[model samples]
Target chain A: MQSGEDLNQDFRPETEAGGLTIRLDVFQGPLDLLLHLIKREEVDIWNIPIARITEQYLEYLEIMKELNINVAAEWLVMASTLIFIKSRMLLPREPAPENAEETEDDPRTELVYQLLEHQKFKNAAEMLFTREEVENAVWNRPPDEVLEDGGDVIAVTLFDLLRAFQEVVRRFESQRVMEVAQEEVTIEQKIEDIRKCFLVHDQLQFSSFFTAASSKRYIIVTFLALLELVRLREIWLFQQQVFEEIQVSRIKESA
Target chain B: MQAVMEAIIYVAEEPVKAEQFQEVFPEESPEAIRRALAELLESFNARPGGMWIREVAGGYRMTTRPEHHEQIRAYLKTRPGAKLSMAALETLAVIAYKQPVTLAEILAIRGKKSSSSLQTLLERKLVCILGRKEVVGRPILYGTSREFLIHFGLNSLADLPTLEEFAQMAGDQL
Candidate 1:
């Protein structure tokens, strides 16, 4: 792994003599730059010439220093990983293991696979954005695109899923400690307790409902019961702001 | 009844919650609804499906299982004109990073007027008016919405990419 100062000193000639402006912002990180170089060179991932890749990788690092980019540790980590892999490839190889005959997989395959996978998702996300642009252009519809005749269908966005997951996690964390000592409570009894709580109150502070529970098992059961209620839409948890205490309101079937 | 719930989720393009079931069984109690939902959840978990129901945004919605995200991406690729434009992305990035910001501030950062782009973002529900900033003019403060979080697969505003990272990315332009 090359330090920023080391890479800068090495590449001083290129910046001082070459009369070319360098910018580190173009590359998000070393991995990003490496991926770009790999694509540009059209090199075989399985048979990557470590020497060539290392040269290009180091050159970029130097350019980053020339541009005065504050390179993070992630880039340095990748640089070390690359250097290690390169050295490993150059080392004298022992005789192939008995199982070596079974598979001829390259050691670099996993790295390439990870790079490819990351790029694939990144591209997919970009594509989704492009689609939104085209859709907006072609159709002059209402602000909300209401798909008619899907009565039971509810459009739950990604944010909604995250919010729900956060709520569940928060509930789990806050209630995990305080134990409500009493007789052993069954899941059925917990469900009954929750129903009774909802019946008396129009809404319960989500945290308050669990404060009475003492045992981990009871908490788990209560959590499961809460999930069941949520799944059934028997209760709706509403938080006006992020990280705020969520309020759970019983949903009337008629309403 | 559990089968019915599974069938409903399977055929529906979006998520379906247990309350949606109550429309079919109008007289059922909340307890009964809870039981039915428990059964449905158990049934779905037992069998394999590309999608599963989860409680989100105060309601139940079906989403593709995380394991199937790649397949979903492949299917999504088959559909045309779904990618976002660079300008839209930049605008989104601005809102995401400097959220609860006003249109004026966004324009200032962007170094140009962004009324049209702001309108587009608002229409898309990616950004929403958080409230009015108490300044001389009381301009509406804009922030990324929950839809924005979901689109980016972030749990909360805190999940947004670090300011340092953005600064590093911006350094390229320098």
Candidate 2:
């Protein structure tokens, strides 16, 4: 493979048979390259001149092969799609039967719309990246200092909360069978049980919430109930440190 | 109340939820506390400072605006060993690429124990547990966090360098 500098040096202004010399770097994927060609030729996206785009697309693929850049399967898939569209376009449009609708929907419309939408997102992403690069070139700040206020507490990330929930589920699952034989329980009942449990104990080790008597169903129901409490602004979950036990408590919503 | 919330954010090392704020203002109704939080959010939003208050993970915290990340990067570059360690990078890569993945899967790819490194990344607010995979073992699934994006100066996961590019770079370094 040629170095970037070597590739630039090898660049020639001489146009190919079709009068197009596409630089690979400007293209993000097969669709992007096709969109550029379509726009450059001023072809209607709804009525794309498939022959021209296909030629250019193939030429780009040839260039990629020449440069030994391994083409991913997605690119190949797009190639076939282009060929299919081109072939469909080549076939003469049969006149609709007298009673049929005046015009059939263009096959290219959906594909073209998708391509345009994708290009728009790609451009937006690129613009954002360029902006980030420029901003990153100038800014500096130290790691956030730990909160010093006596009441300020470190909050857990959603990931941590999810993980803690998962741990609760796992422990509950292991003891599920034994609980299943004991009795049936509903989520509402489980919530009441959990509320009662919390009422008795100031802080329950997250693990203790799921005991051998807890069925998988009961555990899941209980977990959902807890989440509902959190969402309803009735309860809060917290962890003191990494890998430490997560604690849940009734939110004293009212100060 | 505004001062109290700001003071709490300033002092708390971790993201502080509104509920935590309630603990500080125990006498205030949750509704009142929420109203104060809304006011605080508005005040921060109107500010011209580089830092902004953001609700992340389930809490409110102060972080630099995405526009100001380059400044943070430049500042951090001057400090040595502040860069993420290679192990952290690898672990993060696994999480970002194959998100909601389990520790077992991460270890399988890394061919080494990652529990400690994962814990470190979790502590640093880089990676997070998404949930447990509902498979035979129900292993905890991990993924990159929103802070992960903010720290890396990305708006989304798609902003991360492609897996192929990362692999090539890692190969060259190796």
Candidate 3:
């Protein structure tokens, strides 16, 4: 990738011919795309090289146009604005009035301010996205049912198992900087080990089963072994209430 | 009183404010009901339970504890909900931060048309019309809804961290 200063070196004809290969994801808007371009070039946002940025921006739009991407009217408007700004920057500066203390506003001032403001919310959106992801996992009680019948809970949600799995993984990851497990454990071996566990204890806390797992592979194999048992009807997973810890027990043959 | 408050919170589809309870028990003093609510909040929050009373969107409601989010998410995976698109979320963030703003202002900042994104936000009930700007064009003004705060698990608009705070956190993480 060319540095920001290198963008000044003209390659206009070649760029137009090749039409720069660029992947276009849906941008939130023109400012989003402009910020991305600015960051990619590692240019100072305050002192944007209008000509270079405008050329790259237009190239991206041209590629989008070729790919049959529906370039919104707003993008085209921004293209015009960039072109206008570039043209203004090329013109000679107007002489300041003798009595006027304030210097003439840089043509880039409004564009720069808009970019800064838009960038703030772009970051804000990312923050909201993270909050949404975290909050998505937290459940509230569902609206009440008209009638209720007491029954033993038999099905554990995958989330419960995953939470237990995550705890194990997080614990191991925090404890060791480098994981090098000398001994290898197979899924079948883990399954057999679990079966032996059930012989002594009728039920095991889902996470407790992984108390001895030392490596990522061991944890993954054990989790897979548990899933296999569940699929085979050899084991039953249960959660008594929403967000409760899971219990793993034998499926118990019906009389 | 706390028990009744707890039951109401459990059954409510939306967060129930203490003031709303006064309408239900007209004879009860507003302060008394508020005290009961505070007590309910304390007891529920103190318990080591999967769910607890949460104060969000200017009201009280039952929500699963953050610690149990993973387990709750596993159960919810079977029933997937639509997530906001980038444009919609960006629009929402803009509305949330500079609420009671007009479409023209939003467009000026985003440097793009966001009417479609605004439509999605309106349809989702995350944003609502605050009224017209009363300017030359009388453009419709938009603001974040109570549902927005509740959806984001915020107590109020004040609960939203400043953009600078978010920036600081991002900087620290890097």
Best by TM-score: 3
Docking class for model 3 is acceptable
Residues A168-255 of candidate 3 have per-residue lDDT tens digits of 8998788765666588889999999999988888778888877776778888999999999999988988866657778888866632
Residue-level lDDT of model 3, residues B65-153, one tens digit each, is 77876666676454335678777888889899888999998888778888988988886678989999989989999999987887788
lDDT (Cα, tens digit) per residue for candidate 2, span A57-109: 78778777776565766678788988887888778878767887543555576
Regions more than 4 Å wrong, model 3: A1-24, A94-104, A145-255, B23-28, B76-80, B163-174
DockQ of each: 0.04, 0.05, 0.24
Per-residue lDDT of candidate 1, residues B79-173 (tens digit): 33334444455566667777778888865444334576677777567888899999999999988787765454444566544655534432331
List ranges where model 1 is wrong by over 4 Å.
A1-26, A98-106, A135-255, B1-174
Candidate 3's TM-score: 0.63
DockQ of prediction 3: 0.24
The Cα error of candidate 3 at residue B55, in Å, is: 0.7
DockQ of 2: 0.05
Looking at model 3, residue B144 earns an lDDT score of 95
